[model samples]
Structures are given as C-alpha cells and as structure tokens.
Target: MELKGIHHVSAITAKAKDNYHFYTEILGMRLVKKTINQDDPSVYHLFYADEAGNPGTDLTFFEIPNAGTTYQGKGSISGTSLRVPSDSALEFWEKRLSDYNVDHGGITRQGERNVINFRDPEGQRLTLISDETNQGVKGGRVWDHSSVPAEKGIIGLGPAKLTVQDPAPTVKVLTELLTFKQTGSYPSSFKGNEDIIVFETGEGGTGAEVHLEVRNDLPKERPGRGSVHHVAFRVDNEEELAQWRDRLQTARVPNSGLVDRFYFKSLYFREPNGILFELATDGPGFATDEDMNHLGESLALPPLFEHRREEIEANLKPLDI
Candidate 1:
C-alpha cells in the first residue's frame, strides 16, 4: 500500500515559553497538543496545527532548555513548509512577518509555487508555501480563532526538504524503499550545486512531496535549539503499519519496530545518510484526551504515562502559552 503525504515535522526548541508564543501568537497556528516527549519525559513536546490537528497539519517541537544554536548543514531535514491558501496569502504573510519583526527572506518562486522562507525565533527554518496551484492531497481547514484571518491562515503542511551530501542513497531509500516517485528536478539556488530533485507519494502535490537538495559544501548538522529531529510520513492504519514493519524487515532496514505514541502508531528508521524518518498511522488523534474546543489548554499525557502525570508535570517548567 502507498504511504500518504507528510504527517508531521518535529524540531527542537530550547525555550518552550517563547516557542509557544511565537507559533500561537505570531504564526497564528493553533496549539493542538501540549505534552512531554515520551522518550525524554523531562522536556516538553508541543504540537501546533490547524483547528483539528489533522495528520498532515502538525509541526511539533521538543523543548530542551538552553540548547546551543544549530549549525545547519547536510544530513538534515533542512526546511519545513506550511501551506497557506493562495498566492495572495504570501503577500499577507510577508506583511505579517514584517509587522511581527520576524526574520525572513521575502517571497520567491521555488519550483512551481511562490514560497516565503523564514526562521522562527529559535532559528527553525520554515517556509510558507502558497497552494494556489497545488493539486493532489488537499490541505486542512484553518483555525477560525486564529489571529490571522481564516482566508490567510496557514492550512496544512507542504514539502519537508532534505539536504544531504549525495542524493543516491537517500534517493534509493525514498524511491526504492518508500515507493516515492521521482517527479522532477529544479535548478539549485546555490551556485555550483546540482539541481534539487523532487519525489512524490500519495496523491502527489505540494502537500505530498519531498524536495531533495544536494549540498556538498555544508558540514553535517549539529542539532541544538532549532534543528529538526525527524520527519514522519503518514500511513493509513495499524494493520498497514504492521505490514510496513514486515517490509522494512524484508528490506533489511533497521527500524524502531511498532511504537504506540498514544495519538498515533509509528515506525521510525533512519536512511543511509542518517536523517531520521518515521512512518506513522493517522488515528486516535489529538482529541483522544482533550476536548476539541479547549485543546492545548492543559497538559496531555499518554495513557501509559498517565500514572506519572504528577511527577512529569512537576519536572516541566510552567509554560506561559
């Protein structure tokens, strides 16, 4: 069975308070889930998305207090994109980002669409991609309560860019192992570099594509405050997820087996280049524990972690947002 588009992109953030404010207040994306990183219960794991926290809409962050700045380079999920409604939405975001004093490289054409590349306060690389010409997998609905108007609000996720030294192995993992179709290539913005290759999956469009850029010049990424931890692709359900587990075994690709993330089931594996990739099922979503109208108002813990909620809550610094 084919995998769906990008499920979510998880990154690191040193300041949960500021991170919460930036995403919810400035970017205007809704805080869909407030929880702790399951692997490291001491830190916070925050999820921001559309009103419903749909599978393809989430952009999450793990809080690591006082982490160092990321030295961005190769072998990394270089940039994460958020889908907005139309080309005109880019004009709105350009003005909005400026008004908020956010650091950004103004709107420019990337491949076929107009995109605005920018960084969060923690130097998290992000892009606002206009879905004006997007086809295939459609985006999620906007949060009606967002500070940004419904028409201009961020809708869902777009492409997650993978920057690596060589494209062959990574390409093989995506094309051969994951079944992504190499759609096309685009001219590199970097001088002396090869054109970026495009790979597509379910329904194939901006929402369901990966843009691979080969950069032999940059060093291997040293992750800290703003580095991407991993990027997860969406699978339909647990039965399919089990089959995928078997497939990975057959292919001899080591994986995390099957994991219950409470909100979703997942299988995590790194490619030959060492960039983390996860295949996650899209069920038992964020609303599993919280009321939809009041999501992110308080902390949420998985059922297994529920027993230690008090201890977990005590360890986390009280987040303002």
Candidate 2:
C-alpha cells in the first residue's frame, strides 16, 4: 500500500498567458493538458510535464487573475524543486534563466545536492537540482518541443518542501500513517527555518521524497497565486487508492472520497499541519482525452461539463500556448 512518488504538484497563477509562456517557452516543458477548473469553470487548469506526461513529471497551475501573491508563512508548500539531467544541464538552465531575465540564485549546496533556486513569473518559489549522479527520479521522457535541447531539458520533480510549525504531527502522519521512511536531514538555508528532515517512499529519489522544514514562529499563510493548492502523491491503481482511503479512515483523517478527476482518480485531505495532500492514481492519464501529439492544443471538459462546452469555453480566457 506504499505510495509510488509524486503524481503532480499544483499551484495558482495570476496570468494564464504569462504562465503558459514561462512554462512552455522558457521552462521548456510540454503543456500536457489545458482544461477549466472543475470547481470554478471560468479559469483554466494547465498541466505542464515531460514529453510523455508521466506521473511524477506533472507541474500544474490554476489561472486566477484576481488571486494575488500568497502571504508566506508556515503550513504551505514553500517551494517546488525540479530535476535536470546533469551539472552541464544546470549550467544550461542558469544561462537560459539569466537570458530571460528571470531572477535566480547561484547553485548552492544542500546536503549532497546542488540547487539553483528561482521564482516563476507569478513569484512561486522553484528550484532546479542536477541529477548528474542519478539521484533523481528515473522515469519520464525528455520533452521534444522545448526550445532547450532535449538533453538539457528538465526531467521530473525533485524535492517537495513543506513548511510547518512543528513537524511532530506531520511526521506521525508521514511515517506512521503514510509509510514514508525518514532518509536524511539537511540544515535549511532559510533564516528562520530549522533543519529539513527528508522522507522517502517507493524507489526513492527526486520526486519520491518530501523535505520538511520547521518554522514554528511563522503565521499561517493565505491561499492565492504563487501558493501551492495541494501536493499529490502517486498510486499505482484503484487497488492502491482504495488502500490509502482505508488507511486514512483507520487513522481518523477525514478525506474527499474517491473523486473522479477524469484524467486521474483522487482523494484529498489535509495533513496534520493543514497542508493539503492528495493521493492520485497514475493511469487513465493526461492523454486519455486528447491525442498525445496534440495535447493542450484545445480546451478539454469532463463529461459533466461536456454538454455545456460552448458556454464554458466562451467564459474561459483564450490561452495561446
């Protein structure tokens, strides 16, 4: 019943056009899916991933022009780290980010890895880590459409950093309830953050791990653009998804039961620290609705929204990806 790895990390974006350009043209990821937000159909929910749109490769954003920058504090997904192929790949990205005038910091040591931290157009914290020593997730194809060469293009997710007041409760949820094993720890470079404790599940590396940073003095953050809505973990199939639901029940953690997300089945819940977490199945993926070669080319709606497609499409802003 162990979770495999990250299914995807979803965040909010203030500008759909700018977000699309930053992710597709600048970051060089494939726009795997372009759909409207199910809860609020007016905005777009855009998914960016590696060439094949593999489970761990997804980094999605919900367009909400009115939602401004998030208020930073504890109980939020502080940053997302991406895995690149090698040191040379990191160098390539450094030059690319600089050429585009994207604010970024030089590579810094974090335990055994070197990380180049940066922010998106919307101010979402992002990091790029070199996978030169094969320390990152292995699956997922290099994107062919990226302006950046395939060899140096981003591969998959790296560490997911979570900020919390006290890690004890979340630690219990992660280790005792969810089965993540504590792997290592690294002193956080952030001023007020304590040492970050690393936790891993499945074949560990990159997307298979979460880094917990304790910041007891900070206030709770409000959700907005640049805020992570939720962090989803990968499950192999329906059986594994059911097992996780049962485990949540046994542990007395209330969760959203078996949501049919069309692309993937999902169950959402809040971890002890109030950071939203989801268990999502990997199959019936992004390509389930559209042709792989032409994904994200047009708007996609679920069965419930299909009948009102024209109305929905008219309301949503045009995305020229």
Candidate 3:
C-alpha cells in the first residue's frame, strides 16, 4: 500500500488566456487535455503535461478569471517545482526567462539539488530543480511540440512545498497515514531561514519529494488564483487505490469516496494542516478519450456533463491556444 510520486499539482488561475500562454507558449508545456471543471462546468479545467500526458508530468489549472490573487500564509501549497535534466538545463531556463522578461532568480542550491526559481504570469510560485541522480538523463515523455527543445524541456513535477504552522502534527499524518519518510532537513529562506523537512515516497526522484515548511507566524490562506487546489499522490492501479481507501477509512480519515474523474480515479481528503490531498490512480490516461497526436485539441466532457456540452461550451470563455 505504498504511494508513488506526485501524480499532478492542480492550481487556480484567474486568467485563462494568460495561464495558457505562460504554460504553453513561454514555459513550453504541452496542453494535453482541454476540459471543463466537472464540479463547475462554467470554467475550464486545463491540463498541461509532457508529450504523452503521463501521470507524474501533469500540472493542471482551474480557470476562474474573476478569482482574486491568493493570500499566501499557512496551510497552503506554497510552491510547485518542475524537474529539469541538468545544470545546463537551468542555464537554458535562466536565458529563456530573461528573453521573455519573466522575473526569476539565478540557480541556487536547495540541499543537494540546484533550483531555478520563478513564478507564472499569475504569481504562482514555481521552481525547476535537478538532482545528481536525474541530471542529464532525458525524461520519459519529453514534449516534441514544446517551444523549448525536447532535451531541455521540463520533464515532470519536483518537490511541492506545503506551508504548515505546526509541523509535528502534519508530519505525523505524512509519516503514519501517507507513509512518507522524512529524508532530510534543509534551510528554507522562504520561511525566514527555518529548517524545511523533506519527505519522500520511497521511489522516484524529484517527483517523490515533498517539502514541509514550518512557520507558526504565517497566517491562514484564503484560496483564489495562484493557490493550489490540491496535491495528488499516485497509486499504481485499481487494486492499489482500493487498498489506500481502506487504509484511510481504517485510520478514521474521511475521504471523497472513490470518485471517477474519467481519466483517473480519485479519493480526496484534507490532511492535518487542511491542505487537500488526493490519491489518484495512474491508468486510463489522457489518451483515453482523444488520440495521442490530438490530446488537448478539443474540449472533452465527462458522462455526467456530456448531455449539456453545448450549454457548457457556451458558458466557458474561448481559449486561443
């Protein structure tokens, strides 16, 4: 009943066009799925991933043009990091951000890894990191259609930073409930140089890492644009997913009760710090609906919402991608 690495990081974006351009045009990620939010058909639920829309490579957004900027504080997902291939990949990204006038910082050491930090157009905190084991190894699903070359393209998700005021309780949930082991502690300049505890899922490299930032002084966050809706951890198949649900119930943790998201099965529950966590399966991938060559070319709807496709389409703002 071990969890795999991060399946995806879903965040909020008020500006659909800006979010689309920043991720696809500037950052050069492939828009693998163009779908409406199943919970709210009025807004778009866009998925950006590697070439083939692999589970670990996906980074998604919920479009809410009127949603205000997020209030950053405790109990929020502070940062979403992307995995790059090498130190040279970081150099390429630094020049790429400069060329586009994107505000970013030079490469810095985060423990044993090198990270190039930046934000999306909507001020969503993001980073690109390369560890020694993953450096120079070309990733599994490098997008050929991306503006950035396949070699240097962002491969997948790295460590996601969660800001929690109380670390001990949250750490207990991570260790006991989720089965994440604390790998090490590193100094976090974001939390006034406080030590950030790093936890891992036993396998995978950068995608398996989760950093918990302990800062009691930070206030609670009000969710809006640039805030993470939830962080999903991967399970291998239906068998593994069922086992996870059983464990959650046994531990007295309330969950979303096995939701079928069409692309994957999900069970959502909030952790001790009130940050939303999801257990997502890795099969029935993005290509389940559309062909591999034309994954996000058109909007796809789930069966429940399929009857009102025209109505949903009318409500959603047109994306120029």
Comparison by TM-score, 1 against 2, better one: 1
Q: Ranking by lDDT, best first?
A: 1, 2, 3
* C-alpha TM-scores of all predictions: 0.98, 0.97, 0.96
What would the per-residue lDDT of candidate 3 be over residues 1-321, giving only the tens digit for each residue? 878888899999998878888999998899999998888889999999999989788999998878986888999999999987778888889999999998898788888889988887778899988744653223446787788988788888888899998888889888999879998888878546578989988474688878999888768998889889999998888788888889999999998889899999999999888999998999899888899999898889988888999998888777894
Compared with the true structure, the alpha-carbon lDDT of candidate 1 equals 0.93
Q: For every candidate structure, what is the RMSD over all alpha carbons to the true structure, in angstroms?
A: 0.9, 1.3, 1.8
Candidate 3 global CA lDDT score? 0.86
Q: Which ten residues in a row have the lowest lDDT in candidate 3?
A: 131-140
Model 2 — TM-score against the truth? 0.97
Residue pairs that clash (backbone atoms under 3 angstroms), model 3: none
Any runs in candidate 3 off by more than 4 Å, and if so which?
Answer: 135-139, 190-192
Listed per model in order, the count of residue pairs whose N, CA or C atoms clash below 3 Å is: 0, 0, 0
lDDT agreement with native, every candidate: 0.93, 0.88, 0.86
lDDT of 3 at 99: 92
Error of 2 at 259 (Å): 0.3
Candidate number of the best TM-score: 1
lDDT of 2: 0.88
Residue-level lDDT for 267 in candidate 3:
91
- For model 1, residues 1-321, the per-residue Cα lDDT tens digits are 899999999999999999999998898999999999998999999999999999999999999897898999999999999999999999999999999999999999898889999999889999999999988899998888898899999999999999999889999999999979999988888988899899999999888999999998999999999999999999999999999999999999999999999999999999998999999999979999999999998999988899999999999887782
| lDDT of candidate 2 over 121-201, digit per residue (tens) | 778999998887655458577777787798888888887999999889999999998868999999888675678999999
